[model samples]
Target chain A: MPGTRARRSDAEVVAAVRAAVVEELAEVGLGRLTMDGIGQRAGIAKTSLYRRWDSPQAILLDALQAGFPQEQPTPAPTDDLRSDLIEALRLMIAWLTTPVARATGAILAERARYPELAEAVYTQVFEPKGGRFTGTVLRHYAAAGRIDPDRLTPVVLDIGEALVLKYTLDSGELPDEQTLADIVDQAVLPAADRPH
Target chain B: MPGTRARRSDAEVVAAVRAAVVEELAEVGLGRLTMDGIGQRAGIAKTSLYRRWDSPQAILLDALQAGFPQEQPTPAPTDDLRSDLIEALRLMIAWLTTPVARATGAILAERARYPELAEAVYTQVFEPKGGRFTGTVLRHYAAAGRIDPDRLTPVVLDIGEALVLKYTLDSGELPDEQTLADIVDQAVLPAADRPH
Candidate 1:
């Protein structure tokens, strides 16, 4: 096995390990994710894995943190809040289709069994990636004085994500482009927009 | 068993059957729920159950229909969109704690396996009572000419339930009163209120 593993570069080994963790999370889930299992899947040595990370959860969290997508708002505030917000949601929907998102969902579905790991997902994965889908967009405009900064309360920030997440949960499908626009125009913008 | 069941009123039998379905649903979920199990739990005969309902899912849908709560807006609305919204969200949180809620969650968690039953949850249990927790309150005020009727779009109406539902999904607990108030003030009311 060592001879077959070859002298792969450190970057190559890290990339392989990251991909393996995504698949491992979906297949084994929160429980039963072991260093040995990950090592075998990534074609790396368990001793080598231990040299870099301590636990399987740690490795999984690293991949999630690395894979989480950050939303971008348009540069120099065009005063078109609607388009920027919709673009942010589009980024979110695109990310929702990835292997990393599935891995995140897999961990969340077992929140009761692995409460700490679930918390880690929020703090380590989601929070660092803009908290919610429209958060960056809302905050970006708020910072530009186009929207009231005080209006970016947790509930306000959550409107787009909550509705979009609710739709996905209820329908088992991500919101379409029109649905995302509906969320932005009807929910997020109304909640976050400054009064005329 | 027959001796004990003797002389029971139709209402009494139906009540027993209703409670039995709730418990049966939690234990066996949608896939394994059966007439035999329900009859035994309710202390009614399988033939008696068949006389009332043709399928176990039908019996479950009936119980859910009976248990869904109807949210009440302030009789006059009194221009208190905030308080009414908070109350409506409170009603939703209360429903989420019921055994019927657990049954619904069990069904929804396996939506891929029982897609039709999940749809039935929406059309049968949820829609008849109200589309969302805040739907009745929003429509009531709109009818009174306070909020714009057009503001009560799908995303607007869903603001309360979506945030409450998302909160519960993340925390594994229902939103407290203060958080409900945040949802009203920060998200729901702003989206539903008439523009000045």
Candidate 2:
């Protein structure tokens, strides 16, 4: 397909493409998602699609990233780290149970064939959101003089990664609110407690 | 490819096919794996392979089940749930970093085409081991008059699923022992602490 006289900016193109991909995914599953299909749906030329995103996987990653809330809405710290962590977990669980999470699983299934796309999605989208949430919670604990700042990264990564993976692998039946509360109270909050 | 002399029993055929699947997955990654390849590797007729295992996914699931340790090793409870959990985590980390984990991931990638295989592997391989380990620790805690026995399943599933998923999604970078220790100390032990 040839480009029209009206040229869209890169951001506009990306946004359009991303929206089309999601709509396509809902209509036709991941197996049938193709660049040309997405291009047609987005009213963009296939050439334009390929020029920006290397493959359908890249486009799908872009779609997922765009779908998630860009700014991590700061959960007001409750002073009690356990409550704060629970709040974060609740929001994450809700997100994971949404359409975005389904699309993520579909993308992950295709990841082996497109390792670069997988890396891009992980680093650009999933990791950043996860890191931000983890960082904020850990920072709150550190400010209270409860946990060593050094322990933040590893703890957050381990727990956050685990939670996300569990939900994904389980096909989005996220841990219930009670379980989330239990996890924070039992694991996360205590881990932040000042050492004897 | 017709068998003349007494055909092998279904069990024997399943064993041969499963062994061949493992060998192929190990030698050639998931992308290159095929029914013909498995048949040739197993010294079985292509027809026999197709007839027995519905798809490559089925073959891989069978292989995973065959490879999984028959007995879920019970972690000896040292009356200290934390240490027991740490030991369990160590064992889990070791398993996840091994060839078994790699094969499991390969099998998982094909889950969309073979949903049954995913369920079978989850039930036969993952769930049983996780259940036994958690049960052992929880039983010890129960015997000591600590946490409620009813809570064991949810705890085990949440934590076990998370741990395994983290390892899988992270592409085999096993969480360090210290991280595992912290998880046990904070989550498992505290959850098992006697109710005041």
TM-score of chain A of each: 0.93, 0.69
Instruction: Estimate, for each residue in B17-108, the C-alpha lDDT of model 1 and write its tens digit.
Output: 99999998878767789999999999889999999899999999999888889988887626687888888888888888899888888888
TM-score of predicted model 1? Answer: 0.94
- TM-score winner: 1
A60-171: candidate 1 lDDT, tens digit per residue: 9999888888988888725678998998888888888999888998888889888999999999999987898889888888888889898889888888889988899888
* Candidate 1 deviant stretches above 4 angstroms: A77-79, B4-7, B77-79
The 10-residue segment with the lowest total lDDT in model 2 chain B: B69-78
lDDT of 1 at B132: 85
C-alpha displacement of A121 in model 1, angstroms? 0.8
How many clashes in each candidate? 0, 0
